[model samples]
Target: MARPRTQLLSRDIILDAALELINTQHDFTILGIGRHLGVNPSSLYHHLSGGRDEIINALRERFYKNIDLASLQPGHSPWQSRIESWVRSYREAVAQYPAAIPILIGRIVDDVPTLAIYETLAAILVEAGVPGSQHVGIIAMLDALVFGSAIDAGSPEPLWNTTEDRQPHLHQAVASSSTPDRVASGLAMGIEASVAYIERLAVGPSDGAN
Candidate 1:
């Protein structure tokens, strides 16, 4: 009889291990991931042929997979509403793994699901009368807002320590802010500003205005 096989190690397991490393350590190597999983680094290659880069792409997919894309479907809803929904969902998904932000940003996005989300956004931008030339720039700006907000979401509460004596204006602003959820409030404001900017682009510059 053949010897019994060892415990199974699969792609999900490897990816989870890698994500754990990224979350705690802010980065991971193939060796580190394998060590976490109590397996040899070479064994990860069996599941991920492309190695570290592949793992990074996989993690990107994992992060974006949580976004609910149904509201984003082209429909009767105004483009602004769709964009807001997407931003909220994207932030919610990413904020859960804020530590992964640095690692994810370091890699160019090549994940298919993630790209599909961008493609959807691009289509919406096209429908909104945004010029094709500006699509990438708008998307980049939105990414900055969303990712920055996500990172901020993970920051310690009372993000700034201000005192009336040292910084009266800042302390007053922080204390007087009406919104309980600063991150959400700020993200909503940013989204509205971005949408307004996009609308202006759609309308195009006036003849007399400089």
Candidate 2:
């Protein structure tokens, strides 16, 4: 008799494959996930004990683990550049895995692993001379730019839709178009300006007496 197949696929392995399937196919429906994984749909219950929620949790953790903050290079790169790079990294991640956005947004607050990343970001901002007063706003801006970029990339329909009569302002805004890269750069510049403004508040003239 042939030896028994002994490879054990854990939850992480299952989720990793699932995410890749979603990336390649953008299919979130139950049947799609089952077909993509090449396993009986019911078998997913073995790994994802709680169903979709379990899968989402696993994916979120995997995303946090894959983050390449090594590029931040704390001592070498200015905080502003690091912040921009961080935001860019997030945008790139979400663009590649659009299906994760909704899960990310919904689960962010409760997910300890995801919240730790934000905590690291906040600590960096504080160390970079950002006043405590502005921490909340800075975090909000970062979140908005990241999730907004993901939304834009994943669904461009909002940019193209017209409602000139009902939503005149949105129509006019859409008329003035820019490349996604330009938009991300503009957001980064805005973040830099906010940081600079805070730094200026701490600035003082040199003392010639010393």
Candidate 3:
């Protein structure tokens, strides 16, 4: 249950409403969120100067709040497991609103939570013997894979179907697979392989962007 809209509104109220809209629905606009909150669209402008971007950033902040950085500490878990945990937490958050994955990816990540995760990741990569020069490429690769996996998780079952007379081999491959999507397994192994690669390289991290 929720309280009915009132004349009094605050920035926190508006952002909570915005994230609620995003979670349950596909896309949301300023006016749409205003309507959800039973307020005039223009009223939102009094709170958010950058409008939609700010809302999305707030949504990211909300999502990251669930992630416990303390659990990802070096000694608490193996460096590889820490990486997987971060990816798992990230994917779980994004899975709540699969459509917003692209929105998050397209935006610049300057939020404190996101930056902290990146910094932790940077430090972990360094500990794993990765050169700092490759950190950008590694993060980019992980983001692409992890985010793509999240999108795939939300995809409809039977990602592909076939006609009896066409694409026999393709259909066979799909049929032989145990699940409709291999996102979970694929992502798990992908993370492991990434960790293995770093371990194999055995190169120390150099000067890097924090």
Candidate 4:
């Protein structure tokens, strides 16, 4: 005999199922998600307004909740390392569901908690003497690296492989033997460049004017 459905579907349940579907299928369509949960596609609208923004927001909220925000803990070394650590943590969390990238970038919330984190980091950069004008840009750079790296990590190996004769530079860069190490090196380079740029911007007397 088939087991009867006893658990009533709630918004949270729907969202949870949707996230699972996304993880398993790497597809974020509402209809696909519905099939995964054994519910009618239209039913999702009742709990999760059949809109990209709504789905994206729900996913982003879940992503943030799962992250160890404490990764931003105070450290004795330079603020750049702390910033890199935060970016690394963010990348690791989001990499779990690469299909969630578009959702993340869609609705960037700047509410109290989010603002608090941003302001805290901005202050650290300022204390490190980073220029006020470049704060937002610095954060944006970190965001790009995190998101871009997540996307690249999710991509298939064949997409990275290239014909050596046709594309020497590309082939050499994507050489399989050291691909993983190269990705790490690239991420570190991205973070370092952003941090170094901000540190340089901190040089003049107008550093903390904001």
Candidate 5:
């Protein structure tokens, strides 16, 4: 008789299953992943020693890797340009997996690659002459923009639903806007605003000017 073929389980396989669950259900469990993969839940332990936490970190790494890190590298371009490229790339990447955003953000990022991305951002800010005291806050603000934009990108159009009779000015503003890619346009605007703020910080209090 021929020997029975065993189901193959690896980090990729497990992570893929978990991601699928997260995409569909916005959450995942070890047993659920096992069921999705047709393996016993305990069988997953053989592969993921840290189990669910490991899977979450692995998924985080997978998505973070989608970012175009090369654009953020120290370059001859102005710091503003580099920062713009980094955020644009980040929005593009995270927007691809909007469903995973909550789960990914809910966990503290201990992954090496993910941490390295932050490290790179810190280095960029340092090079730009941004105050060390403000680095964490600045980075946090960028993250908020990126994550919020990622979720908004997946939302249906006509973001606002104000009636002209109730709020004529607000309605007119929404109606007058004719951007082809609203999400991208908004993201670009936000990134530009953020970089402008950072530029001001790097320049300091302008020698006593209010």
Candidate 6:
């Protein structure tokens, strides 16, 4: 008697499928995933733990999997360049999955690569003479800039439409700066401004005791 072949499933399959769901459905349930993969929802539990939160962590890991810290390390580039490069890389990764940005932000980052990013950024900041006392606030500001920029990258073209009759100055400004990728330009400016602020902070004192 010939035996029936069983289906094989892996973490990669779940991750890919989940990402697809996030891209399309934007609201997928466990049963939905099971239907999509033709597997029992319980089977998914065998590989993924913590339910939706775990999936979110996996998604973030996939997004940030390729973040290289070498270029952003202290010796490789100036501190300002490092910050700008890191922000650029983060925005690039985050821009891919706009729908799940909230999930990523809501979950605590426990992924190894993500942790390494924080570690490297801290080390670089320390090298730049940023004291430990200010690290949290500065990092928060940087994160806001990066994540906000990521979200802004997907903004609709000509995002604002102000009528000249209603608001002439606003309309004129919008027209003067109108372009296909103004969001991208804004992101660049935000990163540069954050870096400039860091430079100013580096001037005052060596609180890092370096």
Steric collisions counted per model: 0, 0, 0, 0, 0, 0
Report the lDDT of model 2 for residue 14.
Answer: 74
Sorted on lDDT, best first, the list reads 1, 5, 6, 3, 4, 2
Report every candidate's CA lDDT.
0.84, 0.66, 0.77, 0.70, 0.83, 0.78
Off by over 4 Å in 1: 1-6, 204-210
Instruction: Give lDDT tens digits, candidate 6, residues 46-119.
Output: 88977776777787788988788777864575676777788888878888888778767877888777788788
The model with the greatest lDDT is 1
What TM-score does candidate 3 get on C-alpha atoms?
0.81
Judged by TM-score relative to the true structure, which candidate is superior, 3 or 4?
3
Number of clashes found in candidate 1: 0
Q: What would the TM-score be for candidate 2 when compared with the true structure? A: 0.63
Candidate 6 wrong stretches, greater than 4 Å: 1-8, 178-180, 203-210
**Candidate 6 versus the native: TM-score?**
0.87
lDDT of 3 by residue, 75-184 (tens): 77677778788788877877777877877877898878789988988878877778778888888877876788888888776677786469888888777888644777
lDDT of 1 by residue, 1-210 (tens): 976586568989998888788778988999898788887899899989999989888877877887777767766477877888878888887888899888888988788978888888897887787898899999999999989999999888889999899999999999999998998889989999998888888754322121
**lDDT score at residue 101, model 3, on the 0-100 scale:** 80
**Best candidate according to TM-score:** 1
Total backbone clashes of model 2?
Answer: 0
Query: Lowest lDDT 10-mer window, candidate 4?
Result: 201-210
Candidate 5 has which clashing residue pairs, if any? none
Note each model's CA RMSD in angstroms. Answer: 4.3, 5.8, 4.8, 4.7, 4.0, 3.1
* lDDT by residue (tens digit), candidate 4, 92-132: 87887887677566666644444555666776676677667
Relative to the true structure, candidate 5 reaches a TM of: 0.88
Query: 1-32 in candidate 5: lDDT tens per residue?
Result: 97669658888889888878988898999999
Measured against the true structure, the TM-scores of the candidates, in listed sequence, are 0.90, 0.63, 0.81, 0.73, 0.88, 0.87
- Candidate 4 Cα misplacement greater than 4 A, ranges: 1-5, 20-55, 71-77, 110-117, 173-180, 204-210
